[model samples]
Structures are given as C-alpha cells and as structure tokens.
Target: MANRATGVPAPQLLFDGSEEKFDLWETRFLSCLHILKLKETILREPDEASDEDRWKNADCYAELVRLIDDKSLSLIRHEAADDGRKGLRILKEHYSGKSKPRIINMYTSLTKLRMADSETVTDYLLRAENIITALREAGETMSDGLIVAMTLSGLPDSFKPLAVHVTQNEDSVTFAGFKRRLRVYEESEKMKMTEPTTDNVMKTYTRQGGGHSKPHSNRKEEDANITCYKCGIKGHKARKCYKKVWCNYCKNNTHAESLCKKKGGQDGVRKVAEEQGGDQDHLFKAKYVKSDRPPGNVKMKGIMVDAGATSHIVNDINKFQSFDNSFQSETHSVELADGNKCSGIAQQRGTAVIHLLDNAGRQHTAQLRDTLYMPSYPHDIFSVASM
Candidate 1:
C-alpha cells in the first residue's frame, strides 16, 4: 500500500537473521522488493535495466538494509563488495535451514501428536498447540480449522462425544474457542463421574429398605414374608439381609458394630459385642475379597481374573460345590479402595476343584483353597495376587 501523504510506500523492517533464521528473513526481503515493485527492475536484462531505475533503487534499498542491520553488514562485507543483492543471496544460501533435518522432525512431531489416556484436555491442547506452532515456524501452514479437527481427532476415545459436539456446531471454531469448549467438556465429564447416578440412588434405596430387596432363594419362607428389621425391607431375614451393620470404629463397614476392631456405639442397628458369632475376646478382621463387580449367578462364564484382589471370590454362595456353611448367621465384609466395606461376603473354608485342558490338550486338575463366597456378588473374581 502507498503512503497517502508522500505517495511512496512505507518502509519494511530489516532482518539481520538472528538465531540463524534466514528463510524467514529471505522471504521478508523478497516480499519487500515485490511490494515496492522493484523486483522486476532487479530481474530485468541489462538493456531493460537501462530503460528503468528499478534495479538501482532495489540495490540502494538492500545496501541501506545491510548498513542498518549490524549482523548482516559483518557477514556480507566481502560478498556484497559492489552490490547488496549479492550479499543477500549469499546470506540466504548460507543460513537458510530448509535443507536441515529439523523441518522433517517438526513434521514428524505434528503427525505423531496424541492425547494420552490420563492426560486432561487442557494439557493435551497445550501439547498440540506447541507442535502446531513449531510446524508453522518450519514453514508449514496449518489452518485453525485443520488444527481444531486434528486436536479433536487425536483426543482419546472417551472424548468422542466432545468431538461430535465440535463437528455439530454451526459456528466456525477458532483454535482459541475450541480450547475453551474442550475445557468446558472436561469439567462436565468430571462432574458426571462425581454425581450420583440413577443406579446408585436405586441401590442406596434398595439397601435402606426404601426399595424392595431382591429375594434370595435360600432364605426361609417365613423370613421372606415380613420386612427385615435391619434393612426395613421385605424379602430376607435380618441375618440374611446384606445391609451393612455400620461400624463406628475403624470408620468403615468392614465389620458390624459387634465385630468392630475398636469399641463401637451401642444405639445403632447392630448386635452387641457379645451377641456377634465369635466371643468378644476373639473379634478380628475377617478374610474376604473386595471385587469390582456386584453379585450375580452365571457359572464359569462370570469368572474374573483379578491381580488387584488379595483373595479369590464368588458372588453366589451356592456356586461353591464344597462350601462350608459353618458361619451361616455370621456376616463377613470386604474392604474397598474407597474405605467402604460390603457385608454380603464370606470367607470360605473349603476348596474348589477345577478340571481344565492345557496347551497340549491334556486334561489337568487344579484345586483352589479358601475361596470366598458372597451371595450378592455378580462376578467370580480369581485373584492372582492371592495366588
């Protein structure tokens, strides 16, 4: 654009090629000459040059730049003895990193970008943005739309819904705007995880007697007739109900009040210390397995191999072919990672014999010891940690 007052174009910034960045500098110098319409004069034949003063003006501008940029002056002192254009060309050939391996590395980095499973959207966006910036500096032109699409596509599978939301938006997404949306989506997902779900509310009510308890077939007909005093639900006896006898001591439900590791409150729904199966003097931590799945009956198909568990567990007590029902009225609970405990569990005193085939197709028999049984458990957990 020409200057309105002087009818001459505004001067362009001079480059000294600091940090060995000659590609960018060279482009700027060439663009300045083009903008001033002096590039044709410098490229003209000797006869054409004689017809115009463009070549002379281009040379004068280059020399002025060389003088103003101290770094350029020292590098071109010998090369540009007569014409500044020669000095500029040599400077570009010497310092331009176009042929360097860094350009390939930058492209590789951009292509390999990924969002880790544990990485938050905010952190991943920063990582992708840095890669995009490096690619741009290496002369790669990535549009904001491409960046938005790539970032959304590179996100972990859990963000598929967010990706859909982005694609479904009517408004064009700026890179900055997409980041804000990503952050909002991240927060929403976090809230969803923390908030109580419908199933959780249903379970809580079912356990508290506000909802009907699923009947256990082994429970006595008389016991199942009336509501349980412990859980305030109809279907099972107080002894059979899985409602946890909250323990005041140890701050967990791992044991009933009577079986608490420490002294507990007396006014709650649990039996007194002396009323529990064992003598008060013998109260101790029971052996049971803490599993992720709830109770159900599915035979061998339900078995789970879990290294995180300290013991093997089965959800259905009846599935145990040789289960010892010695502690029929006794309630044993398993401790969870969240510090809560579930009461529908028991430590088995018997063994289970498994008949299987090895890789050689030969039949093999294995016996498991002290397997746990939880009448309410859904999956059979075989703990490698225990083995």
Candidate 2:
C-alpha cells in the first residue's frame, strides 16, 4: 500500500538534545533513515564504496547526513566520520551511556511519578511508562505488580475510593483491571461535566422561612412557569421573589428597576432605589438562557491566575498538569477581538482548584469546572467568573 502520509511526513526522531532518550532516539533515527533508503549512503563512507556505483550511493548518504543534529554531526569527524558504520558506532559510543548520572536521574523520576491534582490517570501512566522503559533499558529490574502498585499510589485523592477498592480486592486488582476501571471512571466523570443540567432555576424564600419551604415542583413550573406577578417571574409569590431591582443609569443598588432609566431623578438625575414595585405587577417573565460559549473556567491547580479573561485558556494541552482524552463535541473555533478566526480546532476541558489568600490572610479554595485546553492558545487566560 502507498504510505499513509500523502505528501511528506515530517521527521519524528530529530534529536533535540534530550539525553534521557538517547537509546530511543538512535534506534528510531537509524530506522527512519533506512526506510527512506538513504541509510546506506549516510552510514557508508565514500572510501568504503569502492566502485563508481558505490561512490554515487555514498554521495547521497553524505548529503542526507547534514540533516542530523550538530552534537551528533561532530561525531562524524574528518577521516573517521567518512564511513557510515564507523560514524554510527562512534555516535553510539559517545552518546549512549551506562552512565551513573543518567540512570540515577531516570530512577529519581520513576520514584516521583505522582498523579498530580490536575493530571489524568492515563497521562500519568504514560509518564510512568516512559520512566520505567528508561530504567529497564538501564538494566533495572521491576515487576509488573510493583509497577502497578506504583501507578495506583500516584493517583489523586479523588480516586481514593477506587484505589482502595482495587488494593483491597484480590480478584479484580491486576494491572489490566486497574487500567480498565480507571478509564471507565474517567469516562463517567467527563460525561457529568458535559451533560446538560435542568436544575438551573432554584427557588428562594423570603427572609426567615426559606430553608424550611418545599422545593419547587416541575408541575407548578410547567403550568405557571412561576411567573412572579411581582417580579414578572413564575413559581413564587411576590414575598418570595428574588429578582434584583436593577438600574440602567449610574449602575448602583440605590436605583429601582421600575423607574425609567432616562427619568429617575431628584434634580432630574436618576438615582434608582431598590424597586419595591417588584411586588406590584408582573410585566413579562424572563426565561432562563443558555449561552453559546461554555461559561466557566476550568481550574488549573498549578497555573497562576489570569484575571482578565472571559473564559479559561491554556497555552498547550500537554502543558496542562493533567489532561483527559478529547472531550469536545464539535470542532471549537475562536475569534479574536481583532476579527481573526482560528477554525476547526480540538479543545480539551480541564478541571482544577485554585487557592487564594485574601488580604487578611484567610485562605480559600475555588474549583474551576471546565477549563479550555487550547494547544494553539498563545497565553493563559484565567477568568474571574470561573474563579
């Protein structure tokens, strides 16, 4: 079959100087070069290609060799570097390691594979897998059970219920079982976040008897729609109405909603007092409105708050401390204030808790329900509404 990439597929194994994956880097790099049929030329030196036909192949390899990074490039030095086999061996000898520091670093990362508050189990496992793979390559021995136990211990406290059950139950506690159960939990929780909720309108009672009153019923809401004859809303009598008496001018609580915005005045100046007319007569009831944009911020536990935003945004989804699998229903697009549009994009929603310390030194925690994880977002925008 033809290659999946219609045109050209970008290189995946270009070395970016991350020494931790040198073993992986070398294997993938060589394999990719070989697949392109350029490996023979790059790996074989001109001198080794004795004939005219061999020299042409060697020349092609030499040209592609420049695609390699500077660090590895230096290993292909003057005479010794000319030959592909010798150069590959030299690159391996220098870059590859049984080095104490590399192994120690890998072990340290494995030891600290924590499932952060914002991180999902799957992402945490992938991180752990990478660390475990590195350790294994370093000749470190780790049993599957021990690795599973480590993974379980790293999950957040919210997962404690399942974590405890898995650990305590002998029959359903294998690595595979844990992975399956964890994914199931993740799917269920995500569903709760995206599902439409009906309890938007809550009944409020007057001063003293609010808590003891019966909850609003669907029958009354459906029949009367709780048209507050007082506030023009349904469900409650005038005494129990909670709609605010608003002012259009001077924007203050002192204004009344019934007074005309252009006409409220002592000296022809509008000073809206709280509208007592809310109990006078019902004009028209306002229906609950759902906005097109998902209004709250998804809290990011470790991110600094950006208070000037209308909704939450992260620079990169991967930069998110934790991420769930793709959760948006449609391709979400964003239009900037400048009238530029970003179209057909994928966004993930994240949940996080933010900690705040008031001026008086009292600490409070706020939970963000759904944060937009936009990989192309240029900056973090923390929303006050979400906060």
Candidate 3:
C-alpha cells in the first residue's frame, strides 16, 4: 500500500469566511445549542422543585415573557374583568339559595382551604363564629357534629359557652381534649342537682290524722263514738242497747201480735192501716226475698211482673207448673245475676188473677194484662201479692 492519509470534511462556512464573521457565527450557534440543552435538562427533572425554582426555569417563565413581548395587554385586562363579574354572580347565588347543610359544607370547604394555605385560619374562624352566632340568635339549635367541626376549624373555647346548655353528656366526647375535661365537671354538677334527698322521701307519710288511723282498721273507734238512741249512750247504736220496751203493736211487754190491742190502738192502729193501704194501692208492688243459703227458697205472695223489661219474667217457674200444666209456652232465654242465661216457658195470661188477704183479713185481687214467662229463681222472688 502507498503512504496516503484520509482528510476530514471542512466545516460549512457561514458569512463568507472572514475571521470575525466566522467567530461571531460560531459563538451564536454554540450558544443556541447550549440553551436548548439547558431546556431539555430542566424538563427532564422531577416536579419536586420549589415555587421559586419553578419560576426561575425559562420554559415555565415563557408565558409571562411572551405576554410582556406582545403588545396585547388589553386582552388580559378584559379577561380579568369578565372573571370578576362571574365571581360576583356565583357569590350572589350561593348566598341567596343556601340551606343549612350547604352552609355547613361551605364552612367545611373554607376550613380545608385555610388548612391548605389558600386562606388564613383567623379569617376563617371569624367568619364561622359570625355564622354560628347568627344561627343561635335565629333560634336554631346546632348539633354536636357542627360544634366539633367548628372547634377543629380553630374556633376557641369562648364559643363553647354559647352551646353549653344545648350540649348533651354523650356529645361531650366529640369536643376537643381540653373541652371534654370541662364537660366532665359540668356533668357532675348536673348529677348533683338531680339526686334525691332524704327529706323528700319522708314528707309523704307525715299527714295529720292519716298516719295514726286507717279507715277499716279504726272501725271500733268509729263505733265507740256513735250515740245510742234508746239508752242515751255515746258508745252504742240503738239496736245494741240493753234496755227493752213493751211491744209497740201489743199490750203485753213480752211480744207483739196481730190482734194485740196495743197495736190496734186509736193512733197507732190507724197509722198502720193507712200505710198498708198505701202500699197495696201502688200500680206495681212486688216482694223481694233475701236469704243467705245455697238453693235458697223464695215465697212469692203476688204476681211477679216487669212492665219496663222487654221480655216477660216469672220467678219460681216450677211452682206454677203444678197449678196449670197446659200453661207452658215456648222456652225462652233469660239472664241471671251471674251473667248466665236460663231457659223458661212463656205463657199468655188471659185474665190472670192473684188473690191475697191483708192483715185485716180483707181479700185483694191483682190482674195481669200481658204474657208472662217463668224461669228458675236464682236467689230472690218478687211477687205482687206482697203489696
């Protein structure tokens, strides 16, 4: 091989190969390359840069630089005016249609904004306190959740006193750590106020005579105070007297009978006869029998009737069955005193008559005008003859 050397390509010349011109062009090209390389390095770095560092980067500052370069600053001024009008409209709508929940959400959002460094905590607290005060003056009761939220948003303990009476014991835990300790003392005071005392427990049993005497238990004492009419004593009723008097209806002192002259005397005898006549003259008079035994007997002296009752009733149905065997009618039901019903016979009275003799041996007849039914008498019998 021959000893020949390869040559390098010459640099493309700019501005006609004068020394000053070439030097100036070379400097400009190298500076442009350096600026591009710096931009690439800044873009490749993580966004963990501080605000000042980000502002210093030429690529990030390019928008401001372009705004300064362009003579269209009036466009920026017009956009700012439009944004202000939009903000005013939003504020008006927010204030006009806001509900309690919306207000609370707005307050929470503001608190969060302040926490994130978009607003001052003191300003947020002042605005929130004004809202809470207005709500209290409007007679609205705030919940524990709202109070806790306010406290967490940097509201002071001075606002705590405003809600003291409204707060419940269970809601005390929702407050800040220092406020909860004060709430424990408040609860203790409430407990002391509600506790029962010994004086109140004994007040009910201290009345005048009620403590010494109960009603049924003091019956003997009550009887001892009753005045006796016969013997003229203070300790006994008239029926319990020891002295005895002559029979008012008889001449004898031992007993009184129907024929006794003392009973048939001028004044007493006439009075008795007139009373008996008045009893017999009543349109409806019946005898009611009373006994203190089971399967009791009741003797009916007159016709037993109830014109006011809806159904016919005759006591002692078995007694009338022997007298008129064919007097039986359809068996109907009647209610007894114990709430059970009894089956009985209903009969038509075609001139049903009852006869009875008075104490003077004078006979009287009682007439019936309607149907009568007889059921078994439970314990009492009412009769018209007794009148």
Instruction: TM-score each candidate.
Output: 0.30, 0.41, 0.17
> In model 3, what lDDT does residue 153 have?
46
Highest TM-score scorer: 2
What lDDT does candidate 1 reach at residue 277?
19
Report each candidate's C-alpha RMSD, comma-separated, in the order given.
16.4, 20.3, 37.4
lDDT of 3 by residue, 1-387 (tens): 111363321233122323113234334433433444433333355457555444434332332222221222233334333232222233223333246775565455435532223434345445554555444433467775765555454534433443443342233444344355544645664676799632221011112343542223353554465443323345544334554534454323221243233344333323432333322112233433333324357544443232223323444333232333444455544443222343442443222334455557565654433325442221222333222
TM-score of 2: 0.41
User: How many pairs collide in each candidate, listed in order?
Assistant: 7, 22, 3
lDDT head-to-head 2 vs 3, winner: 2
Q: The CA-based lDDT of model 1 is what? A: 0.54
**In candidate 1, which residue ranges exceed 4 Å CA deviation?**
1-16, 19-35, 39-54, 57-69, 81-85, 101-387
Residue 283: error of model 3 in Å?
Answer: 16
**Mind giving the per-residue lDDT tens digits that candidate 1 earns over 51-165?**
2364464564454354336766776666566454566555655554445576676566666778888788877887776667656655777888888877776788888767866
lDDT by residue for model 2 over 1-387, one digit each (tens)?
Answer: 113777333455556556556667767766766776666665555554457645545543353354457866766766454455566666665655557887887777777778877777688877887787777766788876777788877777777756755664546355667688888988887886799753322222222244443433444433343343323444554334455554555343222344322343332211111231222121222111122326363332323233334456654444344555656526565543222345543367666444455557565664454567654332345556445
Q: Candidates sorted by TM-score, descending order?
A: 2, 1, 3
Candidate 3 ranges beyond 4 A from true positions:
1-331, 344-351, 371-375, 378-387
Winner on TM-score (1 vs 3): 1
Give the Cα lDDT of each candidate: 0.54, 0.53, 0.38
